[model samples]
Target: MSLFDIKRTKFNSSEVISDFSHFKRRLLDEVYETKDELQLVCSSTGIFEQFIEILEGLFLHIRQTQTSAPKIRLLFPKSKKVNSFLEKTNISDLPSVEIQYIHEDEFQYFIAGVDKSISLFSEPRRNFERGFNDSFFNVISLKDSVIWHNSAIFESLWKQSILENKVKDLSRELNRNNVSNHNFVRILAHELKNPIQPILGFSDMIQNNKRLDSDQKNELLKIISRNARKLDIMTNNILDYARMENNIFNLNLEIFDIVQVIEELLGDYTLQVNKKNIKLDLDTLSKKIMIKADKIRIIEVIDNLLSNSIKFTERGQIVISVRETDQYIVVKIADTGCGIDEKNHKKLFSKFYTTDKLGTGLGLYISRIIIEKHLGRIEGRTNTDGIGSSFTIKLPVK
Candidate 1:
């Protein structure tokens, strides 16, 4: 017998249908007949070709509605064929068709409804072919409780599916970031070791060489002191970075001479600048440009900028200048060194990013944090002539 004829013999004299093809046809017919709304749920809609036919039928049904059209929603389990089905149907062109995807495991049957007059359910199947009919299928009464229960079930599954996809995306992003950080930490450890090896060797020599002249001993001692200071700075940068990340680093704000801080830091680098024959100069609008901030952190910010300039410039000049506005203090550190590329200007302060292979890349990052903590911002731009870069800092006066 034909599918409709078989459904007639299988079902009572009601709206219920047993044949799969008859059930699908009647569901589409109801969508065409519905004056209120239509909803559908299924594990999968079989092949791409079958899904396209259903999409076409839905569009046609909407078109045939001469009066007010019914709202339509389709919920189906996500499958490999979803993208292809959407591609062929051009679902974006049909705004009336609302669809959402759930995990394939979450939906194990077929259910469809139209208004409050009809509801249908069927055993899950890979396709709609009648030859493979192996499970129960029938339309049920469209009572208030049955309709409410099915609607609630679909809503819960839809929300859960969206959450699952978001969590998966976040987990993937975190994994990638963790791997990048792990590699950077390994490099930072190597940088810390470089200064220590020289410090240890020089200390051993100074201790053993008893016949050395006073000048020779003093020179060795200075070398030891420089290396030790370098190691100390590196260690402190990393510790500060950790403390800042954990939200435990607090500022000790005080009023201090901004010029004095710059001059003192410059004096510390005098020996190194003389060694390289580079000129380090300072300029200020006043002898005392007082500002309220963490004195030590401000010193750190300027020290990092000066160090960067010295590292890149072989025989050029570095100028540090301080000036004040009505409500802000501005410090400008200009260099005559190899300038950074324009494209890299924005990423210069990112953590663990450096142009030099041996650098730990934490200096600029730490400087930015300290400046921001003081209600200030730090920025660097290549000089107009392209010979070097200038780092500018603006701190609030209040």
Candidate 2:
């Protein structure tokens, strides 16, 4: 019988429909008739997939023909197969569709309801055709108690599904954070050990090798000093990062000649630069450009940039330039080194992000924080020549 005939004949009563084709046609008719809301519950994953395919076509048809669409809510058993289907299909992208998952054991029957008018119910079956053929349903024009009961059950289950989803999302976030913390500890330990090993080795050699020449002793002392400086820089970076996280970091603001600081810092790197056979150049229009800011933090930033340039450049030169614009004092450290990839430019200043194995990954992050704290800006990009990378820092002249 047609759905209109069935509704007229089966008013205020229920009937068992044993024909799969007839049941499918009636189900589609009910969905098409729905004006406000449509709810569905499917226990069998196989049957649910089939229903999704059928509903996708009906939904498209409704969109083309109808002026308004009903809000669709679907509850299905959570399973690997169903999850895979959802990932592969665009059914969820339908504008009116909202889906939630429940454990397989939580529900045993398939149910569908349309806006207080009709409800289809079926017992668990192995296949979609058999399930639909064995279904019993109710259709009424008035307020039916069966439809009301089904709506209540669906509302309760929907709340439970939302809670469970939130819990799962929180669990995944905690897992990711745990992994990140573990990696942070591992990298910090390795960085700490690297400079300490050399510092201890060189100090011991200087103390125990009494027969060594004066020049040999001086070289060993310089090696110890260099390693010690490295240890100091790494520890300071860690401490500063912690302070920044706690929002307790303070800068020692003062007026100082930035050119003098760069010159002195370059003097320290002369030996390392010569060892790598890389030329380092300084270009400045003024002998001393005085700025009111944190001198120590400014030195830290410039030192970090210069250190990276020297470490990466095996043969080419590094140029440190200081210039004055109308509103800002600009510093550019351009290097002909192994340049960073274009993809990684955005993440360069993110904490714990690094391309170097031995790095603590806090230098650029801390440098960015310090510069911004002083109302300045810093950016890194590939050089125009495409041979290396360049970092630019701009500080307000006023």
**Top candidate when judged by TM-score against the true structure:** 2
TM-scores for candidates 1 onward, in order: 0.54, 0.55
Give the per-residue Cα lDDT of candidate 1 at 3: 18
Per-residue lDDT for 56-147 in model 1, tens only? 78766665663566677777666657766666656545656677776564334666677856666655333345543443345654544344
- In model 2, pairs of residues that clash are none
- Identify the leading candidate in terms of lDDT: 2
| Residue 86 lDDT in candidate 2 | 64
Query: In model 1, what lDDT does residue 53 have?
Result: 60
Worst 10 residues of 1 by lDDT: 1-10
Q: What is the per-residue lDDT of model 2 for residues 1-398, given as tens digits with 9 covering 90 to 100?
A: 12332333433556666555566677787778888988988766755755665566665775675447778898888898777766665558767779999777533466788886777765433434565545434232343534544554565456446544543443354366563455655566566556656555665455444587879867766765676677667656766775786699998889989999999989889889999999998999899898989988899899999999999999889999999888999999999899989999999999778999767678999999999998999999998889999999999987
Clashing residue pairs in candidate 1 are none
